[model samples]
Target: MRYIRSIYIFCSIVTSVRSGASELPEERELTTNFSSMSLTKVPEGLTPITTTLDLSYNLLFQLQHSDFRSLSKLKVLILCHNRIQELDIKTFEFNKELSYLDVSNNRLKSVTWFSLAGLRHLDLSFNDFDTLPISVETGNMSHLETLGLSGAKIQKSDFQKIAHLQLNTVLLGLRTLSHYEEGSLPILNTTRLHIVLPVNTNFWVLLHDGIKTSKILEVINIDQKSQFTSYESQQIPILENAKTSILLLNKVDLSWDDLFLIFQLVWHTSVEYFQIQHVTFGGKVYLDHNSFDYSNTVMRTIKLEHVHFRIFNIPQESIYLLFTKMDIENLTISDAQMPHMLFPMYPTRFQYLNFANNILTDDVFKKSIQLPHLKTLILKDNKLETLSLVSHFASNTSLRHLDLSENLLQHENDENCLWPETLVTMNLSFNKFADSVFGCLPRNIQILDLNSNKIQTVPKAITHLTSLRELNLAFNFLTDLPGCSHFRRLLVLNVEMNLILSSSLDFFQSCQEVKTLNAGRNPFRCTCELRDFIQLGKYSEGMMVGWSDSYICEYPLNLKGTQLKDVHLPEISCN
Candidate 1:
């Protein structure tokens, strides 16, 4: 579905460019990248037909009222990462088509919300505004959907005004609810609300008062784990609207009864996307698996990170039973030391599973490996040494991305040990493997990372990987290009910091589709042949032979420190 949308966008952009109505040559669609220049004003000569202008990373303390008046066709304007303290009234009035404005990370004490003809998204986060300038009256921002207020100490009244807009998404500050007034949360129609309440307050009181839970479908609560303390413990009855909300709790302290209490108060919120991460608890945390049952629920995703289920001291089967009922579309349980070996003989609805940083071994993986709809799997930083291809993953053609980096899969090489070879992206970096490690690599991988493996030579197995597009063999013991003429669609080739004394340009010329090749920091013999191979652009009749200008000579004392791009001379020819 995403690929189709990308194709649609590509076709639309191509049509727009060909028709000349989108970015006309006369429009000069983009100009002035005075970013991080510390300028005090908008760059000059910004044409009227300019559709996109960036004035970010500057020291402009104030925007002139008529600064953007001339750029009437401007649709996207970036003023983020600046020290702008003020925005003059009517500053963006004339840019009728301006739809996106980012003024984040600035010194905006207060902004007079005026007319921006077609404003749809506004990011004013990390500013100095304590009060919002939202008006109850319908203004040009009627179409505004996304409003970011993170790092801004929003005043209670100002927050009420901002809530009246019925925005689709709102990002509040870290401590937005610290001084929560009982009824500060206005009757908003926000579909998604993300905020972190400080630990010092009665969070239950704020949750009960500020928010009208009916309008919220997704809630992200981030607070320090130290802020949580065991309060009254009880099992509250579930509400009828149990499945309407998706909850995300990040870096929050969990009281024994807190999770159950939140589910009770929100009626399980009919949660479809539930993620609890970075949870902190003292001593052993108990889990009543009975409290979590999604058989009759529409649970889509369940991610539990750093929440010690091992400390529960529960039965291994009991832990598996907790996830048995969930028809999870995406599941991530990291650092919990889950007994994957105890998995049931049932398939999950999961399309994505990230069980990284666990005590997964060959035996555990064989018993736990369950995939039918799985597409992207992350098994990084585990103890698995070998993967069974014939008996397991080879049959799962649905898997596309596999990350087995930083694992103990070095000495586990075998003949029938092919991974989901058809995987599009494979990350096998940071593992203990030598030159023989190529036998286990997949064939149809498009993007392959074999960095930091101490590989002395290009894998003879690469000949089988004809579908390779991007290969990262950086920080290895490689000495030369591995005859990449077979990689017809290769785009990026990185072999930096290797032990290569000489490399052939003919190999790259065959893979002409490559646009980026980094062979820097390698010991290249700077002989006559090496000098002739360094030519690019006009030196090679507009052909990109040499990709990096940083490729310097490491041998031949006379030509030692000469850049590959600057070694053009009549004497340094094929002769």
Candidate 2:
């Protein structure tokens, strides 16, 4: 069905380019309004155009083969920010002089020979290419030098085809590269390749293959698991003198075995930067240890950003000593179970230490992690069950953005926990809180994620959240909401999967500042009152509530998977 539309759109663009209606010599169209415009017209005697055409942000639906029939002099074509779906060399027959082509930000499914034949640089990013290409012959792109196939789905087979392409260089996105199968990377011909993979043994195989193929190449920029590869292999003789940086993306995939493997790999090399991320793994990942030189490890920088470890009873002082000689900056040890002594006893070189996730029970805060140069203390997500630890960092005066989400905190009276004061972004979601808990947070909080908790209603006392810009309360037990017109600065309100009924539509309408609303998966009754809710959801900037098609009718009008925004209210005459 869509194939016909794309073909029609392509015919229109080609006719316009050949007719020379603002189409340049270099195929670059910018901010042109071509929305809902028909491409069926084949302008008369239109010819003689060349080099660089920009057809972006034109609300174009599709690109067909007949569009480029008259663009014989075209070189570079920029079709980003359009609605192009498919591409083929048949579309480029008019542009016989084509070189570079950018078809990113479209809805392409795959890359094939028919689409690319005559170019050097091609940008096919931000499309849907889930698997590697089926065609692998290589003559499709003969003169191509630099290709940007980043963010596309290129499988092992496609990679093998690319390797066979014998191109010298390319830039790819890591997010796209991580989706590769466990053990199927294509064979390579380049001397060096920027490979991104999880910290698994297969990555080792890829590195081994690259080493065997490209020995004279420079620079091996690796992610978290790359740290382990640097230490475990004798291949360092091949890449030793080359400048290397192993970025440890925190918490994505770090097992105990992988951690020690990475440490051992980095122990002897001049590798720089060990970064941690925000994803959490099991506590068992940090249990293993490999031997390293306690005295001579000379790597310069060590950053533990967003690392979650569970070392309750182990002697962590040695881990601290490992980084004594290095200059550490953003040290974030978040969402972990750590002992009290993980902090440095004396003023050290680190500038920030974010121990945001821990079991901060009594006696945990008696002393501080004395990082005199420490400027920000993010203790968010810690089960601060009690408020005793709050006073520990109060003296620091530099702490900002304290998040205490998902904590089983209770007040001094041992009943319910309240929000903290003077923080930038306080995340009190998924916690047991009293009605007065909102009073504890100062008016300085800018962001709050109060989702997934036992709160049954929105308090009218929310005037204090005037500084708040984002609030998330999805998956709660709330059935009703109080007036929220006071939150002038609020931009996002996520209340998906709640017990919101038709009566809550008025409450949502009052908050005019809201730009995004998530009301999907809620028990919303399709009553006449719900009609207004549906209407507001359709018209409001909030996502789910803005559309009748987006709003899933949970009750009397049970639309299991309908988009409420796209639904028509007249068709659903709720009784």
Candidate 3:
């Protein structure tokens, strides 16, 4: 019953509009939004014009000839997001101007490309054309720039398809077969290709081809979406594939032993960027001190985000010993809901370090890691209690950015003065500061985020940041900012989601240089005291209060929920 009514309502609206509007012009594109309409064919007498035709999100099962009798000049045809299974070659012959066609997200078994002589871009992905063969002389798709066949079962029989098409970017599904003739990969002569493999893929045999013709391959993205897992391989291949830069192992579930093997392989691969996050451990991995032969170890950038970094039975001493073996320039290791783990004391050449989403406390950094080249250190969502341990970096002059947000840090002593003198940005959000201030920070600190804290009053310590560029004090309990009078160089300030009234916007008077100001999402009093501030935020271009025109009034029962920007408040007379 509901289905019939929906179709009736849709037809009613479309027919009503179609009867009054002019015919779909020959030069204009047509978009028929029949989403969830259970449509099987194009509607009768709806001859939309050429250049483009979109029939996305429909229940189309097949495409026939008469469906496009009117679109002779159609260049781009999108039949995606439909249930199309069979497409007739005669169906597309009606339109000779076709250049780009998308038939993805369907159930196509085989498609004929002979009619599309001028196609430049073709997407046939997410289909079930498992064993498709290609033609030699008849079909000329030599002008195609991009051809995507992701999630299609591409076998050796389908290798003929690549032999003909002239594509710059060819995206294919994973292949695990062990054999490939020397001339088999001539099809990838001058194209960039990306192949997905499982985390446990035995890369030795699979890499022989890529290493032989390194320039032919581009990226080797290892993901967890595949069903195959190979654990017996030990050697990791490093190809002269100059285009292969990133080795991302996202959500790789491996045993502790496999993890070590993967790390060793990556270390030997010399790939510039390597990241392994959301790793699941299968068992314990024991490593002797002799495991790391750091004789010719190059300092590589590595990030390990085992948010569940401890599914194995291992001691912190072993972890630190193994991790510090490399000359790490940038390192990130984090875990959730674990006991406090110590930072590696050895990575002295570090530059960017992200230790966020862990169980690290302030005392963990009591002994500095001697990284004079370190620039950024992220410690957000941790268990830091105080800034007392910041003194450990007293000798460091290169450390710049430090993040301590979402921690247990409290304002006790002026220990923030001990932060590195070269520091630029700091995040101290979501702590237990109410009315207390922080005047002990370094003068060079520019960007500060004190958002989501219980700050009822603006900490007078903020004015000490004379070189501050941006400040975010959002989602607090501040009725007003009496301490913002000193922000001269501040460019951005977001104080949204607070208990702020409109009359207290006098802080903007001091922020003459502030470019972006977000004071929305607060309960406004709707009295005449808010006219200047509301008007300035809604009308003025310099101080962009985000969504200032859409905010609503919360007080005065008569005007409750009224859009604050729409309301015109009278100016109050001082007399």
TM-score: which candidate is best? 3
The TM-scores, one per candidate, come to 0.63, 0.46, 0.73
lDDT of 3 by residue, 1-575 (tens): 00101000111232234311135554245544444566777666656454556666678888877887777877766776687877665687877878777776677777664546777766665566644324442236667775656432333444555566556655443333233333333344335443444334443333334423222343343433322234334334343433333454555565556566556655654355666656665455544434755544343666777645545676655665576556577777776454454445554566777778877776566665667787787888888776646544533648788888888876654444466778888888887655553544666779988898887876544636678888888988988644356667888888888887764555657777777788778888787777767777667765666665546788888888888877776665521
Point out where model 1 deviates above 4 Å. Answer: 1-186, 200-236, 240-246, 260-270, 282-287, 305-312, 315-321, 335-342, 357-359, 387-394, 411-415, 459-463, 485-489, 505-515, 536-548, 568-575
RMSD of 1: 9.0
Where's the lowest-lDDT run of ten residues in candidate 3?
Answer: 1-10
Q: Rank all candidate structures by their lDDT, best first, as comma-separated numbers.
A: 1, 3, 2
Count of backbone collisions in candidate 3: 1
User: Which candidate model has the greater TM-score, 2 or 3?
Assistant: 3
Candidate 1's displacement at residue 397, Å, is 5.8
User: What residue runs in model 2 are displaced by over 4 Å at the alpha carbon?
Assistant: 1-242, 247-272, 275-314, 320-327, 332-341, 345-363, 371-383, 387-397, 410-423, 434-436, 461-463, 502-510, 525-532, 541-546, 549-575
**Whole-model lDDT per candidate:** 0.61, 0.52, 0.60
Please report how far candidate 3 places residue 572 from its true position, in Å.
9.7
- Using lDDT as the measure, name the better of candidate 1 and candidate 2: 1
Alpha-carbon deviation at 316 in model 3, angstroms: 5.7
